[model samples]
Target: MSAIRFEIKLHSCNDRFNNPAVRSPLVVEVDLSGPRLANDLFFVLHDDTTGRTRLSSRLTGLGLAAAVLGELMLIGRVTVELTDGWVGLALVDAAPTGDTLTQTALDHIIAEPSHRFRIWLQFLARTAYTDVAARMTADGLLHPPRGRLSRRRAPVLANTAAWPGGRLNLAIQRRQPLNLQDGVLLGLLVATSGGQLVLWDQNPTYLSASTAALPAPLQELIAQTEAAVADSVISRR
Candidate 1:
């Protein structure tokens, strides 16, 4: 059987933070192909202080859906890939060293047994620490919590039952053009995933004090979408 090889790439771009000015955006790429291959990736970004996430993404295939769903039910962990061939996974924490990619980091991510989605989310959370620092230099008021460090052990799905509570109420405005059902789905995902989710509300007055500190452009974008959705709902009535 052939091995399912995984490769990762990280890119950085200059932002506002830095003495002479040195910052960059980080991008990650993952690849996998093999017999009976299941490729599922999940990314999560959390604010250290609130233990809440600003964003999350999931990628996966069909065969493993049962396992993934099972894991989510029991522990929120899913099996990302299972091939008769050799399997490989990679993790790259790009922020700390700047322009550095290490094989050891990749080796660690591959060795984990948790679903690919969880691994990706963990990687994003870890890397965000450095990314946020760089972001702060450009906008001091745009502060989010730093990412947390996982213990050096095998990765596992987080237990939603034991997760912390969320202070922010996710209000999906109808104006964003998102279907009411779809908006509800997003809310359900976040609620079930535990308290790490926050809905993007366009009303500045509605935003939490913490999020309100972000740049005006970002604030407007968040609100405009929500407002659009809200208006849509009103029109139907």
Candidate 2:
């Protein structure tokens, strides 16, 4: 089948003046595409001053927690996009650290059902901003102590990795049928596999709702793959 694609954008905020009081923001982008497998992205955010690192994963709660922390820490903004068989997430310039809160949230998400993608994304954006604002206040970055700010309506398109020469090992297990909107959740797990995009179909051989309901082009690609695999097996014997 036509290879699926995914992309990621990252932003970071750091103390530029070597003082916790002065923070500078940084932004980055990444893209990945290939066969649907497992563990496609790996993300890390570090607080240089405290030597704290937030290892990111696609666990629903973890993403939200990071977003929340970003808000609290005065981290800028993060944007994620999924389109035409590609998925990507973007962040301003904030260090992401894996902490108890993030881990706990991720665990909770995993235990939940597949219908929570939109909720998770909404939560991520809201919490991250809120956490950043709160953190700024706690760190004396902001005055008057403002509450969580609402996000503007961003574009949501109709929707949509892996690499070698790397040392880290990643495993992605597709335990259930994830709908189009929720597919972006995989991007979170991408952070664990050195930023490699991995998708595991619990029923890899079976057609996904997205696949069964695919456009003609994708359908043709799947047909070609099936034929090719059959040809290979026959020739081997």
Candidate 3:
């Protein structure tokens, strides 16, 4: 239910970058190595048919937040700890994440004295959509409508079927082993929304098998986040 609140917070944001929009124009920074976790989630969550996102901003936000956290976990930038019977985040190495969005998530966790996962999830989820979308747009992976008339519309990507998300979904569906980064990506996607939004004809059994391939700690984290996402979606339905 608290997870549902996280989704609601993300959906309620009408202007994703208003607070940070006035800063400057976007500059392209293609990783070439691969899409960042947030960018991959954006590509996966986008709706090709509608030129909008398939998942609500909330779900997308939570997914992105989870992705950011997962990325950090993979890089040894952060880790979770049990405190007073609650799982909270702990800083591992304060080194820069290179990517701004991931750094922001790290900064948020570091700045706040409290480390509750849900609290950080809610904050990052609410903010990640705009940051990730802007990065994708800058990278030429997505095309956001221009002009004041389309200002309120959500961003969309073209030829999404050819994007990295397609490969990720294929890997999951085929139950193929993924490298650490992809494994984290798949686990985060599955955890946040059961990969329903990302994959067509989602098979629960297949998802379970794919998830089971993750490292034990990552598996537990994803499973917890997945339960929260499920509760949020079910409540809305």
Best by the lDDT measure = 3
**TM-score per model over all chains:** 0.22, 0.22, 0.73
lDDT of 3 by residue, 95-131 (tens): 8877777787788888884767777777777777777
* lDDT, model 1: 0.27
lDDT of 1 by residue, 75-119 (tens): 111222322322212223222211122222333344654434333
**Most TM-score-accurate candidate:** 3
Count of backbone collisions within predicted model 2? 52
lDDT-based ranking: 3, 2, 1
User: Looking at candidate 2, what is the lDDT of residue 3?
Assistant: 25
Which parts of model 3 are misplaced by more than 4 Å?
1-32, 149-161, 234-237
Better of 1 and 2 by lDDT: 2
